[model samples]
Target: MTRNFNYWSQKGVKGPSPSPMFGNILSYFITPRPHLNMQWQKLYGKIYGVYNGNKPVLMVAEPELIKQICVKDFHIFSDRNTNRRIHPILSKHLVVETGDDWKRIRSIVTPTFSSSKMKKMYPMIRQCLDDFIVELDVYAKDKGDVNVKIMYGNYTMDVISRCAFATKTNSHKDPNDPFIINAQKVFAPKVSRALCFMLLPTFVLKAFNMRGIAEESANEFFFNITRHVMKTRSNSQKKYNDFIELLMNAQKSSTNNNTKDVNHYDENDSSEAHHVNEGEEEKQVENKILSSVDKYITEEEILAQSWVFFVAGYETTATTLTFASYELALNQDSQQRLYEEEEKQAENKILSSVDKYITEEEILAQSWVFFVAGYETTATTLTFASYELALNQDSQQRLYEEVMTAVDSKGEIDYDILARLPYLDAVISETLRLHSPAIILIRQASEDYKLGDTGITLKKGQQLEIPIYAVHHNEEFYEKPNDFIPNRFLPENRHNIKPYSYIPFGAGPRNCIGMRFALMEAKLALAQVIKRYRFFRSPNTDVPLLLNKSTILHSPKRINYPFGAGPRNCIGMRFGLMEAKLALAQVIRRYRFFQTPNTDVPLQLNVSLAIRTPKRVIIGIEKRL
Candidate 1:
């Protein structure tokens, strides 16, 4: 029996009948959930709408619309629509906060990550990298096929913990550090994804939070570390230029200058005036003057921000580094070329004699490569680049030649020399274009806003997401968009690319702050690996890359190479990349990598927060003269 329904309204407004409940459920379970919105975009037009239960959601794919939400209308969409039930740990932190509170916190914390401060912290970063290299040497000497992914995570965790928190987390040495372990448990996608706290019903899931890793333990671990750092800084007579010092000073100044207490102020005000009869009174007042005009950050705020920094800085960098090694294993030619470049740079007579033997400057420069490229797109690029190289050896060899030539001219791998390697840069750019790390950048509307020519009004509290994976894969923007072709990033073709079409790190004020760092790290790592070793198709590797649907970052389902990309991206990207480069260089300089009979191609992938091989990435390693 057909029931007649009026489908069209007065102004050509068309509405389809409600979809069957079963169909919706089936769609949720079977389809790649991440791509579901993108699929809808194709069917319902760019600004299509959907309902997660009764909640209305609008998915925007048009670059301009995305830009407006993230940048132009940033005030309207500054909060991240974080699921409190699923991500209770991050609920009170800066990443999920909104409105004036976010602004104030960001203002106070921004100075901690300024370029000048980061430069000062480079020495500490180098120390972490040195430890990583020693660890790698131990692994290599054992002649055991190490899971590069796990090792990479350990390296980044150690670096970020020490550099950002000014604490000796020592995750590399103590793999079971409660903070590191609990932090990983917190982001486990399977558990977090199922808890979908963004929907209004998020409160219902809070009951289940008791079952997983105890939230208190994680919270305590983070807070204790922060409190220790804070107490040490506050009591110390000496001053240091670390992030902790900045926060401590800011907190003290804010607290002292606070005039909110009426009674206390009245008493202090009278005492000050009474003592101002002599010149000595003015001097005394001047000496007692506070640094700030207002009170803002509380102990809780400091602890919360510090916790966010650790969580944000560590896991992301670790994941990227893990993926980077996977890519190096697959792309031998690219790896060899990079290594040759490093060799050339090291041999350059222009550099100080001390630099040839790993001077602090050399370590700093090399370490930056690791930290910047360790995670985000660099690691993912390495993975995808290797996947393509393994599939298309011709392109891999061509890129190798370009890197080799570029490095040879300088006789060493200098920043300026590396920059001139167009083809190498192209290879890196192409990898980022295809396999961006974070597929979606989500923000919540803080106030009412309009988007695009449609003039659609987004109400306050609405969730905004920029589907980066969809944008990168859009056929209109890229020809044979699915195919891996490094040449697309070449100078001749790069100009043809449209603005905003490529946003691996996003764009504008909110774009990734760590982009330069990530890129440099990836280049150096890739350069070093390519110079020393060669890669071939491993039978153990999955032929077509399978993505781990659970992660925010587009992690692979199997062991893959390279790191991921973005700004507000990974802070340890430079450190991770350098580790990969150095490890690959040392190993490749001594041995060659080859596919073994035991190696599997078209291998199955285990999808999770980070990509992992179902089994070992079994390959034969042979010593080379």
Candidate 2:
């Protein structure tokens, strides 16, 4: 234990002092994560060390160092932090996989959120958004305050279910829906449990078989549902375009021929081509496959990926929506401008838009990833957008105008029209900046590596964290970092910003794969919502917004862009943006949103797994005059 505590000191790394068995864990618990991180950076400079129990973590914030770690020297830091003690259901997915395994899974999953796939999946997302509007209508008619968080959660859940598995829950109308209940449980705060996973010895945790961050029942629920979906789909003759089908298709392609291109191009696909290895031969095991050569994913891996997507997409997207709306609500000028733009140019309707073969477990996992990743993040984007628009009315109105100006001569809204709107893009980017869903980007050293020109050396297996929120808020990187300024992201002003300084989804090879999908979903939702309604603060609304104590990250995070950076960036970034734009366009075109007595002035937030989401965002809405 003494040796463990002396690890950082021996290396001559500067950091806050650790005490006893808890190390710096106690300090972490008492101080807000964002504030504490800032203090550490100010005190120890860009690179510092901290202990989570006796395990040392090197915190990196310098852009140059970050660039090297995430891009130039990626091979040495290819994997994110992970706990082997996590349940198999959670450990096998793309988010947790390491080294070659991660590379292979990523290759197989990259195409799943291709622009073409997102385009095809738009209708499914639109249908879900349409349901979302209907749900909002109840409050719009009563002139009552609506809770955007809960509402967006339902909408995102529906989108994931529909788009991922071709299943419909209409969660917006049925809050008690089993899927919603289970998903909520999966994201429910488990601070103590998570702490244990961080502090306890790996052997102790393995002996106890700790489930890590999620509830066993919820994990089982998702697993069982995924399995059932896979079975039902496999037994049927019907061909459907969804995530499960795509994963199945991947399986067929893999099993049929190992020599097939892992990064094969589809003429219909619009996403960037994934890098291909010329002559790497892949070997396949009976149930498990490694890298793109083998081109096979096990049932457990599939299930794990699905679980990650669900948890990843669900809260993150929904949280983005929540904050966007909150900000827009507080700034009615932005909201009105966005609304007018939508009314003048956006079409009357918002547009919305996958297939495959293979094992019941494999099928289920694919379906799960779609639902998990697709649903929450998109919904969260909408929720945050609504919140932001309510706060920053001018930005909202500007976005609305962009939406309106982009409409076709016949006032028809389509993927192309929405995709091209710059202000809408700026508004959503700004929203993500101020309240990025991902608080930090994590990496682990693969070998003994020395800091750039610095005497400090990181031993192999050292845990590293890039303080995303801290960097985003650094005064050096962003002027008035706490202010909600969309102009910083505008095409004209974007060049003023620096690279590796704005990572919401993350950067490098291990960045979020669903980024494009999440952003598209967010932009679509924000466009539609701004067009139809204008969000305003209500009595319940938190005027200044107070951060939750237990949340992992806090403070205002600003960035010039929102879709991550470097080689790993967000694959679904385009799709997520499209979805968000479509939704925003559709909503703002028809309704006006404003603050009601019940709105939470300084929105109350809570941590849901990896996302920091509002408990509720109550705002008044009315049909556009």
Candidate 3:
């Protein structure tokens, strides 16, 4: 039966009219609101409506309403609203699952990303960074400017590939590894899925059985690499303290328990009479054994979780680091400050260490640049921050003073020290506000729930999304919303901001888990870069950055500043920032960055599978001393 209702429209709360055939179809593809989605909210108000011919989906902007739907009444919206047909290609991993399966998977995987585990992976991260620095030194040997974006991407890809997956992607040397190639294919925006198919019901898509690009080869490649590593480790009985080792140990424990359970059941005979004590004893043994075994993870489950980590980590971080270099090239002042901080940090480390010198792990932990999370988002933020700084010198100077004074007094930079610099924090925050990389935080509704005032129920098994861009740019929340202003995020002014008004990482139970990492990276990278270079408007840079609306992450049409935002945001955010800061500091300490007539200030940005510059940022680097 066809269902129709006036719903919220009856109460004068206006929204986009629901269209059965082409419900916001054109807008979904052509204009993805690269910067912000406030225009829609202004036109439609808090409660908006959309229909993909069959399903009625509402876009709610009110924070309280979103909280209620996502948290308070989660049961009704428990199931994910995606096309289950794609499960084969896009495995039902933790990111897409719901209910008991999600609960179980999350429980098993949560420990993998704990603080202790990340600390253990620090050495691996530094190894990748060292390799990256060597590569950079080679490129900069001729004193020729390098494409920072590509360099950073290669660095990040190598780091995550080795650290997360326990495999070598060598994206630095071979850009076309099957693993990388397949990942790009899988994540690439499918025109049908983004437009027509995204709205189609899961049942409808499954009935037709639409197959995505065959991932058999990619899966085989990854699986074999994992299997071989596992076998070798088992054979040697050697243990390396890494994520892969943990997974292997977990798998072994699970297998042993399973074997014991089978043997116990087999031993029990139905016809044999047993005493009450014997039965109780058996039950106690079973309970104890199962309890111990249940804590271990399975091989299949590990592969799925680990592979997702690899795929998600590599692509996002690479894109972010690339964008960050683009920003450093443009914003010389910010770059210079960052470089100065690095020098001071290096000097302080050398002076403080008596006999036992600072190891790579110590460097990684202390260097905030390497710990920040959102690489792409932060890089983009830097790009935009540079643009705004160049455009508004007063704000730039204010930020410089804040960073320099703090570093000068402390002798070395610390996370808490950096946090106290209100202006710098505000500038970073403001940049994020203006150019958030992720536009939509996609999640399947856990269950059915009613939206505010709109009595219509959002049924289970429906895909739900929070329009991050829209929330950040809402004029109702931010004054002169489109214009860049650092003061808006200043201490006194920040109180006016709404609860969910700025969710680059999202909110509620499933917010981006790596927010701290991203922030640390950004702070460190920016600190080092700004210490040496002085950014000025270049002819290559477009006065007003033209955003590429095609890709999932918001990217510039030219090489802009780099940095991304959010929680489950970017794990290597800190690492990317430190790398950027180190590179800038090293170069700027020796040279002055100036825009030649040929320099691309508003350079064209290439928005492909990853964020890139249209061409290498051309600038004249002159020796300072």
Candidate 4:
């Protein structure tokens, strides 16, 4: 029953001691997973080992080693351990696939999230934001304190649904919406806790026929939605610029795929019927059908992709907005600086035109990826920034002044202008250091690799969990690691931040795909908010945040930090951030945020829920004059 997976020490990798029965499981379970990883990094060494269940896990924090593992030698560590095989469809998405399959899909989808493509999606988000602002005003009128998590979550869901699925239902106003209901049902932690993936190898779990993922009927319904959408698109002559259109286009193109050979190969080239021996060519076509990537996207595949988008994009931003608003409510001095300022506009040169679309399976996925990762990650960081600012007014005011001095009106934020607010950038960075929502940069070793000159070698199948939380909080890298100090990220102080130690978005080749998007969004939103409303510490503001025990993935995503890392990092990071910035900017422009008696101070994370989250963010808002 007890085992110590001290493979690191056996291989001469110096690090922390592991317990026999649970290895580091208990440690990770009690504290946040990232914090746990950091603890071992500090107590043992930046390079060490701990057991993940029964498996040996390398807890790497050293920048140089991190650089190598995440970048230079990514080939050997390309696969991730988190695979969902129970679901027939969900498992097919790029997030769950490994090796060449992952590569093929990633390529098909990457272009959809490009700058031009995202510009097309922006209007959808803006439309959702407009509704969100109106909703906020309604809440501000009669509410004691509002639950921002719910508010923003619905807003993001509405936005992603329209842009990614090309289907719309008012998730905020309509609780009975089938899409929202079914979306919540998928990947429910209740099903997972009963039959955990970590308890055994993925294959073994698959062998046993465990239903850790959503049930079959649920997936069937989900599939039907996408199927209907695709059928409608194909039969109709209507044209839309959203993700569905792109996917349908890609799907239609792939229907005629004919692999290139020597001198000639065209997707529509069925001339083999005219030239080649029919029987032999037919047999060869059969092999290719089974071997190569699916020439055409399946309805199930498209639905699965759609589901992933809904799941990933919905909950994240709502939580982030909640935290951002809550923090602003708690820090009045910072809020005051904003009350004295205004907004600004930007030029249209920043926008672009899309040249191509992506595979339907990929189209749905990338659209969701752009929406969710961009929406939630940045929102969460803004939440932490607000929290930190409320508690640390000095930093908050400095940021508010920057926003005030940078922009002149309530219009689009120029990219160049957003870049000018260094203090706003610092606040975002510091907030990421203290909070990062997604935890760790996970990479799996593909082959035996040496750990620098440390004489330690990691064998293939072994996992590396670079604790973003620990690295960000390491005292060696950050003085008073626990404090909220934006100056730590200032231009003069940024160099002191050691290369990998400050990887909120990770480092090297496999860093977050949406890093640029997230930063831009956060900067714009914070600037806009500071230009208008003042954030003050409310009675409900949590002084020292507490994480819940039964968190779905790992510790509470309540704080912020880590958008993941490596070749498999979050793909739609840019979209999420853009939505966040746009929404936050709009929010602050309309009203001032404050705390109320119903707010939960020293906020308690939800113990019963699968995801680690604040129980509630009940913040008050007043209309700005």
Candidate 5:
């Protein structure tokens, strides 16, 4: 791989000089990936290459080229480079699946996320948020330093478990509950790191029953619990309206399908192989794959996907809320105005689409997709929105007034009132642009593709990395790219922004499936919070926040713009947003947040992943008087 660095340079792929085991990591140590990518673009033009690990990754931010690859040439770059064909149930999970299997599974699972389904799940989410508020209220009365991240995480996990898995337990009250404990173990960084170990291949890891990739004890407990749950459901006379019911239907269909396939195949064929032509053989294979969809969504598959859902939803939502709490604490005037004006309006209504009467496995997989794509990113946006609001008071005040007016005219906030609060929406949009949850977007090439006008081609088997932070902060796309300005996304200024320059939930068909859900969640949460409490700077508050790494005072790129764009954007974007917005709304209306002795102002963000979460954002609380 080191040998190919010069080879790429000869082919007009100009980038940084790689050094030893560090490769370009030292440059990342200097700055974030996006900033470094933007710098490289200036040195070697827009279309360039840089070494990440042992591979040379193409980094391009120009819109037209992005459009061609993500929209037009999607088929050639249909799969993600990280999509290895591993053995675990994780491999069967859609996030990493490529080509036909991906398409097939996607089709089946799409319906479970439809507006109607989300509507059914809304009550559960609301219940979770309500429970969350109760806890916050206690903290406010006690004047305790609230660790909102942990609180929000527990809240989100409860909601996902209820709506997605048909279980309800207060995770915060009983931290040792199997659901909470195993979830931590399964999604722990060590487990994730273990999964990435090249030495422990998927089959070997599975064969040896290594708990490193997935905690064996936790996995077994969950599997047993699921089996029992299913058995109880089978005997129960009452029907349920949650995800469990939807998946159980799929399980029934799968059971019926396996029986039919076994019987039909035997009676219809004398010989299985020698007599068939290539075309006939292809048809058989296709039919078998479809049959397997039903066949696989069994008890084992259901349990596997439930873990996926738990792992994805648990932390991401909690972390984002924590950040928002911090931001609200720092910007008291804006918080005060929001409290005065927004005693107010709006329900959330999202546009467009998800699935057929999909199989049990497919439905379960889709739920996982919803959780993974939706939760953390939405939470991060809420965090950033709070941060920016604290930093930029005028925008926060404007949004607060708008929310107040809408609520004054209408009843309690619902989607209708939310529609009138454009400034509020704008604030959320700006936050997403600046602190998009997903960090780097990646794609693999199945065929060689060309860069627009540059004539430099990306070869088959090559990978491309889009530096989200760089593009979002690039001066070319946004004026005063580093500033926290919500007006940039106002209707008048929105159209002037370059195409693909502002993808918070990404762009294209393969973009985040849950985009609208996340948006709805964030808007609602912010609206409620803005109206109830005044967030003011305290002794613990730090001015001009800092990421975990060094603070780059003068960023070279455009302003705002986050999430990713393209065929493989986050799938559960809307769902996550909805949860975040609602949760924030409920808490803000009831209590005021303040900086505490424990509050770490000018937060040091964790640079390990894309989301800019603080190592800790402990905040003080007071019941709004």
Candidate 6:
């Protein structure tokens, strides 16, 4: 442990001195990671070291260095830092694979999220949003506190289930459904697997044959479910245009081609192969090459991919929605503008929408990775976007205007239209910048490499932490770094931003594979909700939104009960709560309220009635900015 502490110093690098055994864990535990990381960067400069229980991890935030590592020198940093003790089920996942394995699997899965494929899956997402809007309508009608996290979580889960497995689930209505319950457990495990992985030595964990990915039961549930779905789909005649079916088609195509090759021709007989189909064969070959990069993926890989989709798509996207709604609520003007954008678009056109591993333990690990990666990140993006929009109405209104203009004449948004909405895209980009789903990008050095002219040499096996949050907030990279400014992402201004500095989904070849899908999911939901209902601050709203990363569900917490207690509680409790909730939801969607010169700071009250009431009240209300 002492030797590990000296590891950085020996290489002439500067960092805070780590204490015995615990290293920087004490500080890490007490301080929030983003703040702590920013402090470290200030003190030790961009390139420094921090110890995670004597594991020397280099923190790199400098843009040029980051570009070199993530893009220019990607071959030397291809693999993510891992304990190499992955569960058997997850061992084969693309996220876990390195070098050739990663390349092969990535090629096979890349086409699954292509523009054409996203177009095919858009209707499924649209259907899910229709249900989502219904649920939101209930909230709007009842005027109750909204738990956007849980609401968006269910929506993303519905999307993943439908798109990944061709299975429709009522997650929006039945949050306790088995699919969600199991997926949630995988993400927020009952046990602190992350703590264990960070604190326990590999040898100690291996001695007990422990798997860190998920509870064995959850793994089994997904494994069995994925296999069953694949089996049932294979035997069925229905041509479902979902993710699993796509993989199955790839597998089937590969099998048929292999059989044909064995029976008819050798690899060298290109002429003979062409003769079989004539003119159309050339077009087919080109299409196949473009669409299906490789059809040689195995059943295990396909199953792993399915599991990953569930894990990855679930929470992240939901979190984004949660924050986006919260922001819209706080910034009523922005919410109104967004609503206008959607409404105007409605006047114009229609709305449309919208990974894997290997090993028994390895396969489970892949599923675990997918669920964790996809689920919360996108949701969190929407959540933060809402929160920021609520605070910054101008940005939201700009986004709305952009959305309105981008919609087709039918009032529908298709894949191409969604892609083209610059202002809408800017809002999401700025949202991602402010509340980046990923705090850091981890990479392990494959060989000894020199970092710039800083005289720092990264040894083989060194772990690199690209502090994304820090870089994003650095004033050098962004003006008024902390402020939410979606305009910065507009095409004309985007060129001014540094490359590798605004990486919410990372950069280079190994960046998040599900980025396109996540963006589409978030953009569609934002457009739909903003058009129909406006979000505004309520008494239950949390200002500045204290983020508890460990907690996935956001429920309103009320401290003061103005109506009194127990049997003496106000008779209008239910009616008041409903009236308040509904009024805020409906009114805020259309207008903005604030204090005026005529409004008294402390309104005169009449105590004659059973309940003290304001004698007279005055305030200003206006149409959305």
**Taking the tens digit of each residue's C-alpha lDDT, what string does model 3 give over 1-625?**
1233344355444556645455544454455454224566777776666444444556666666655554444444433444543644234344444455444444333344443444455445545554655564554434444434355445555554565446666666688887567545544545665443554566765676643322345554555555566667777766566545655554455444433321222121111110101233333432332233234334554555455544444333433333333343444444444343344433333221100111111111111111112233444443444444444434443444444554544333543344334455555556555555555555455455556666666555655556666766777878887665656665676667675566554443333333333343344444433433333344444534455544356655443222222212232333333322322222233333334344454544334312222323333333323
TM-score for each of the candidates: 0.70, 0.87, 0.69, 0.79, 0.79, 0.78
For candidate 5, the TM-score is 0.79
| Candidate 2 wrong stretches, greater than 4 Å | 1-3, 27-31, 258-293, 340-377, 407-412, 549-565, 568-572, 595-604, 607-610
Instruction: Give model 1 RMSD, 1 decimal.
Output: 12.8
The local distance difference test score of each candidate is 0.44, 0.63, 0.44, 0.52, 0.52, 0.53
Off by over 4 Å in 5: 25-46, 142-145, 191-231, 234-240, 249-308, 323-360, 367-371, 397-412, 415-420, 542-563, 591-601, 618-622
Error of 5 at 594 (Å): 5.9
**Model 1 residue 455 CA deviation in Å:** 6.0
Candidate 5 displacement at residue 22 in angstroms? 5.6
TM-score, prediction 4:
0.79
Choose 3 or 4, whichever is better by TM-score. Answer: 4
lDDT of 4 at 442: 71
Candidate 4 lDDT, 12-101, residue by residue in tens:
767656666556565545565544565667678777776766677777777667656655566676667644456555665545556665
Clash statistics: count for each candidate: 64, 168, 92, 35, 68, 83
Q: Could you tell me which 10 consecutive residues in candidate 1 have the lowest summed lDDT?
A: 353-362
Candidate 1 lDDT over 425-515, as tens digits, reads 5555555555555556666666676666675666777765666667777888789986656556655666566656676555433333333
Residue 171 C-alpha lDDT in model 2: 83
